[model samples]
Target: MQVAILDDWEDAAARFLAWNDLPASVDVTVFRDHVPDEQELVERLRPFDAVMVMRERTPLPAEVLTRLPNLRLLVSSGGRNASIDMDAATQQGVAVCSVPSPRMSDSVAELTFGLMLSLARGIPQQERGLRSGEWGGTVGISLSGKTIGLLGLGKIGGRVASIAQVFGMRVLAWSERLTDERAEEAGARRVGLEECVRESDFVSIHLRLSDRTKGLLGASLLGLMKPTAYLVNTSRAPIIDTSALADALAERRIAGAALDVFETEPIPTDDPLLALDSGTVLTPHVGYVLDTTYEDFFTGYGEILRAWVEGSPIDALNPEALSRGPGDVRDGDEDRE
Candidate 1:
């Protein structure tokens, strides 16, 4: 069976995650660069029996997925991927499974603090001034007495709250469905959205994307925030409207923002946000990138491919495909579950 790994941007697919579970007989190919369109993806992967995808890199739409008749398994790096159309995979008789994700909050939470400290200390600007022999160029704020607001008290939020305590900063949290128990566990006080936004010196967003969270922070919510405060998003970008954010940043409606994710990734070099000087900090979609995680991610991907060739697929995305049987989807009961 042929196995293909798509969108290995760092060229880490084969080096980090391959060979652990792959069968010697199977041929595995890795594509290091991203293919921009569906046609290229379909043609490149049409011959493979299994495919490994990076998170949200290839948005296997219903049309794009239907073209791959031989594809029996789809493995994504993260356990949860919004890009894949699970229903479409079920219709195509494909088994989509995800790799187990290790706890990834530490790296992102640390980066968040780095950005916060940079902003508070004027690190970026001072570094530039220092190169030109300037001294005491910029003044900055301190985190000692600041109020930090967490938008969601989930895995990453809990970690951030702990770190905030170490800094002697007050921590508050808010989410539509976040429980009071979860907030207390994180050492955060439960506050309404407006209160969290209005009072926080650093507002960090950690919510997952869904109907309720999509476009949750925008013109209305942002307007409620203090102009002296900073907003940090290590979460999905669409959770805040791209245009509204750009407008706020342009008008200096808010002090600054630090972003790790964007509404559209690779976020075109010419994007308006890129032209802003006061965004505080920016990073590509690399909140989850780490050397250690890749080893486990790719190894698991290879396992799913080898299992499919043996007629005993595991961790299928569309479990219903298991009930339809081989050569058809009748035996794809494992997929439905």
Candidate 2:
């Protein structure tokens, strides 16, 4: 069976996992470049029996699904990929499966600190000044005794809150469902969303992307934040309005913003937010791409592929595949009725 692994940027797939151990019957091909247009993606995916996709990078829209009629199975790197059209793939008789997510708390939590420290101490500006032969660089703030606000008390947020305490920063937290007890347990005090943003020295977001959270951080919500406070989002990007965030950063309403995810993956070069030097840190949606985690993701995809070819499929997200009677394998082997 021909399996095409799409969006394997940097060609890290072959080196990271046990691809060579895959059954000789399965021919795996990993493509690094992204196929952005639906027509292009459809064309590229049409010949493959299975395609592995990264989370939310190349959107498998309904249009794209309609064109790839030859596709039988789809695998996403992360267990929960919002990019794939689950309903559409199901209707098209595609078995969608996901790999297990790796333990990735400390990596993101540590990176969040880097963004906060850079913002607080004007690290970027100072570096530029020193490179340009200026001495005093820029004034910066100390983290000790500062108010740190966390917007979610989940695994990643909980770790971040603990680290904030170690830095002598008083931690506060809030979310749509954040409990005071959960906050207290994480060594954080829970507060109203507005209060957390308005009074925080470093406002970090850790909310998930759901109907309740989509566009939750808009102009009004951001307008409530203290002008000196910095906003950090290692979480999903759609949580904040792209336009509104650009406006806030351009105007310096908030000190600076650190973003790991954007509403649109591969943020456009013309994006207005890119123009601002004083108030932004941008990462390519890499809050979860540590080497250790990538190893787990690649290995998980290998398992999913093996189960599909072996007749009894496992982790079938498009659950209907289990009920389909055994079909002929593409390598000219006919199924015994």
Candidate 3:
């Protein structure tokens, strides 16, 4: 079976999985760089019988899925991947599998606070200045007595709320699914979205990207924020309008903003967000990119591949695909049957 691992940008898959230990029948190929063009991606992936993808790095829409005639099994790093077209995969008789990482939420939560603290104290700027033979020139604000508004109170957001209490900060949460009782249990007060934005000293977004959330926070919502308030987004980038944010920061309407994820994975060098003089801390989307998380993902992927080769797929997200038969394996191989 020919297997392709897509988007191993750090080349960490080889270190995490023992490819040689897999059945000798499996031929594994790893692609380290990203291919953004659909035709290029389709041409490159056309030969593989199976493909394993990292979290949403390369979208496998119907346009790409229909082109890969040999593809049988598709494994993703997390329990859910919004990027993949499930309907398309199902219609194509492609079995989709998910590798669940229990540690992902905690890892992202840690980065959320890292960005918040960096913005609050201007840590990155001060560190650069000190390296250039300059002393501390900026005053930092304390987290204590500040009000933090959480956009979503899911596992990661809940963890952030608990940590905020440790810093003596008040937590206000808002989401379509969040209830006052749930907020109370999480030590947060449930409020409307506009109210949360207007009242927060620090607004941190943890909502998933979806049709409803895309462009949710535009100029009007952002204008409601106090000029001293700061914004931090560790979630999907489109949740907030990028152009509106750039305008807000450039005009000094808000104190600053810190982001771990962007609309583009490796933000363009000429992106306006990079040239801003206001307080801004940016990271290359390292929220769930921990050593432990990678180990979990790659290990699960290896197991899934081994099981599929044995003619019994496991951890399938779309069970309907199984009825189509154990996908396009080597013909006339008695062991495969």
Candidate 4:
């Protein structure tokens, strides 16, 4: 079967993943760059029997899914991908699967601390100054004795809260799913949305992107932040309104903002956030792009393909597709538990 790997920006899928361990019957192709245009993407993907996609980099809407007649299976690196149209895949008789990486949450939590420290201490600015024969320009604050407000206390947010506690920083958290008992376990105090935004010295976002959270931090919530406070987001970009953030930074309403993800990947060059010098720090969405994560990705593919050949698909999101019994469709079931 012909297999295509989409949006391999780092070109590490074949090199780092255990692709060679798979049976030689599967022929794989990798696309290193992103194709934003829908028609172009549809045409490029038409020839593959199965395709593995990077997390949210390339969207698979119903329109694109219907155009690819040969596609039988779809695999995503992460377990939850809002970008994919699961309903469309099921209607088109495409089986969707996802793999989880144990280390992805920890890695993202670590980078959150790194971004917070960089913003608090002006490390990047000082490094740039030293390169040009200049000394320190302004005083920087320390994380110890400061307050960090977390938008969610999930696995990644809980990890951040624990680390902040060890640094002597007080942690506050609020989420739709976070209970008072869970907050206490993470060493965080449960607070209201306004209180979390208003009282924090550094506000970090860690919530999942959903209907309720699409614009959770809009102009009104962002306006509640202190003028001296900093904001950090390693989660989905749309969680915070892009225009509101740009206005806050441009007007000096907030001290600064650091982000790893954006509403638009490979952010447009003319984005207003890019024009700011010291008030913004941006990264190209490297939160879960570690080597360990890649290993899990390829290893999952190998296991998934093996299961497919044996007529028992595992971790399949769309089991109904197998019922069609189209061509080589299997009859067994081992869905994720």
Candidate 5:
């Protein structure tokens, strides 16, 4: 079986997994760079029977899936990936599997605070200045007595709320399905979205990207924020309008924004956000890029591949595809579980 691991940009896969330990018949190939073009991606993956994707780095839509006639097994690092077209994979008889994500919430929640603190105290800017023989000239804000508005109170948001209370900050939360009981459980008060944005000193977004949330924080909503307030988003990028945010930052509408995710990965050199001054702190989507997290992901990858090659596919998102049988290479092999 020919296996291709896509988007191992840090070259951590080989460090975590022993590729040579696989059956002598299996040939593994790893691609470190990203291929944005659909035709080019299709051409590159056309020869592989199995493909392992890191998160949403490479989107395999129906068009791309249909072009890869040899692709049989698709493995992703996390339990769920919004980028993949699962229905299309099922139709194509592709067995889609996901590895268990250990401590995903903890890693992302930690980064959320990392960005929040950096913005509050201008840590990154000060560090650079000190390295260049400069001293502190910026005034930092304390989290104590400040109000923090949480856009979503899911696992990660709940964690953030608890930590905010430790810093003596008031937590106000808002979401479509958030209840008063749920908010209280997380040490937060349930409030309307507008009130949450307008009243808080810090606004952190933890909402999932969907039809309802896409461009949810547009000009009108962002206009409600106090000029003294700061924004932090470690979640999906499309949830907020990129152009509107750039304009807000450029015009100094909000104090600043610390973003760990963007509309495009490895944001372009000419991206407007890059032109902004010290008010913004941008990171290359490293929310879940911890060492322990990668260890769990690549370790699970090895286990799943071994199981599939042994005629038993595990942790399949679309089990219906298994009913149709494995891809062309292992057509007659019966799936044990």
Candidate 6:
């Protein structure tokens, strides 16, 4: 079976995982760069019977999904991928499978705190000053007894909230699905979104990206933040309006902002956010790129391919696609039946 892996930008798929151990029947191909054009992506992927993708790097919209006729199974690194059009995949009879990575949250949660601490203590600024043969010239904010607003009480957010409590920071959390009981368990007080933003000394985002969450934090909401407060987002980029964030930081509407994700991957060299030299910290979305996470992800990839080749697909997100048959395997193969 022909398998294609897209957006292995680090070229880590072959080196970091056990791809050589995959059954000889599986012909695996990994694309180390992202193909931005939908038509180009479709043309490149048309020959493959299955495709594995990095989260949200290359979008599989309905139009793109309809063009890949040979595709039978799709797998993504994490259990939830906002990039794939699930309804389109289901309609096209394409089985989708995802590997669950609970520890992935641990990686993201750690980065979220790292950014917050960096912003609060001005660590980066101090390090740069020392390199220039200077001492501290700027005052840093203290985390203890400070109020931290958590935008979501999901796995990553809950972890952050617990850590905030350990630091003696008051945690206020808000999410549509977050229960009061759950917030109490996480040592966070449940509050309205606006109240959380308005009252926080530091605001951290940990919500999933979806239609309702896209541009959830616009200029109006950001404008509500205190001029002394800082913002950190290790979650999806579109959750906060990029233009609004750039404007807020450029004008010093907020004290500072740190981001690990962006609306576009490998942020454009000319992106407005990059021009601001002060009060901003940026990373290339390294939240879930740990060695352990990659091992968990690729091991699941190998297992999925093995199961499909053995004619009993596992971890299917779209089970109906399996009813169509075990994908377009080699002709007259006994195992295919």
lDDT of 6 by residue, 226-326 (tens): 99999998888888999998999999999999999988887889999888868888989998888778888888999999999998989998786666643
- For residue 36, model 3's alpha carbon misses the true position, in angstroms, by 0.8
Q: With candidate 6 superimposed using the best TM-score fit, by how many Å does residue 316's alpha carbon deviate from the native?
A: 0.8
TM-score of every model?
A: 0.91, 0.91, 0.93, 0.94, 0.94, 0.91
C-alpha RMSD between model 3 and the true structure: 5.9
If both were scored by TM-score, which would come out higher, candidate 2 or candidate 5? 5
lDDT by residue (tens digit), candidate 4, 1-337 = 8999998889887587676677778888989999999999999999998998988899999889888889888988878887999877877778898887877888788899889988988888888899999987768899999999999898899999999998999999999777899999999999998999999999999988878889889999999999999999999998889999998999999999999998888888987788888867788999888888888877887788778767788999878876653334233420011
Sum up the clashes in candidate 4.
0
Better candidate by TM-score, 2 or 4: 4
* Winner of 3 and 6 under lDDT: 3
Residue 187 in candidate 5, Cα distance off native in Å? 0.9
lDDT of 3 by residue, 2-30 (tens): 99999888899879987777888999899
Clashes per model (N, Cα, C within 3 A): 24, 0, 0, 0, 0, 0
Worst 10 residues of 3 by lDDT: 328-337
Which one wins by lDDT: 2 or 5?
Answer: 5
Model 4 lowest lDDT segment of ten? 328-337
Model 2 Cα lDDT, one tens digit per residue, 1-337: 9999888776778787686778889998889898778777777888898998877788897778767867888888767777788877776777888886646676678888988888887877888888999999567889999999888888888989999999999999888677878888999998998898888988888877888888878999899888888899888888889789889988889888988887677888887777888778777877767787787778888888887788767788868644433232122110000
TM-score, candidate 1, is 0.91
What lDDT score is found at residue 220 in candidate 4?
99
Candidate 4: Cα lDDT at 201: 95
lDDT, each prediction: 0.80, 0.81, 0.88, 0.86, 0.88, 0.86
The superposed Cα distance between candidate 5 and the true structure at residue 331, in angstroms, equals 21
